[model samples]
Target: MPKKTRRSVDGSRLMQEDEAMTTGGAPGSPGGLEEIFGSLDSLREEIEQMRRPTGTQDSPARTCQDLKLCHPELPDGQCQPQGTQKY
Candidate 1:
């Protein structure tokens, strides 16, 4: 009696089928979804950081001194005690 031979399956065909099923046959570069989600996550982190308080001193003297240095064009009164801005 002669022994029967088994045929091998094509690996490339299997891979293609898997990719099609996973991506739903959408026409786009690979891994595009991951990149977009990564960008959104980073943006969310940045927004959260902005929402948090900076915990810096808000004393009138310190604020006035900083304003004077940054806005030399402003009159000394604006950078002084009564006119000092919190922001």
Candidate 2:
């Protein structure tokens, strides 16, 4: 069970301001979609950077063998090399 609550005018005003900031647009202004797209592009770039591997010891690049060395801790047998059997 839940009780219904009404939003106050002040809360509504704050939400409008937050929306403006999120869209990078003022009330009754154009180019809001462009601004939002630009923000999204920036966010995409940030996410790409975070996905890249850092050149530190903890984030050092390793080969498939190295990955297999740590395979016991891997989920779904990831990094485990497949065997080549002769017929």
lDDT of 2 by residue, 1-87 (tens): 455467434578778877876776766675677877899999987665445433224543244444434443543333223332111
Give the Å error, residue 77, model 1: 26
Model 1 Cα shift for residue 37 (angstroms):
0.3
- Cα lDDT over the full model 2: 0.53
39: Cα error in model 2, Å: 0.3
Local accuracy by lDDT, each model: 0.55, 0.53
Pairs in clash, predicted candidate 2: none
Candidate 1 Cα RMSD after full superposition onto the native fold (Å): 11.0
Worst 10 residues of 2 by lDDT: 78-87
**Candidate whose TM-score is highest:** 1
Per-residue error for 74 in candidate 2, Å, reads 24
Enumerate residue pairs that collide in model 1.
Answer: none
Give stretches of model 1 more than 4 Å off: 1-21, 24-26, 54-87
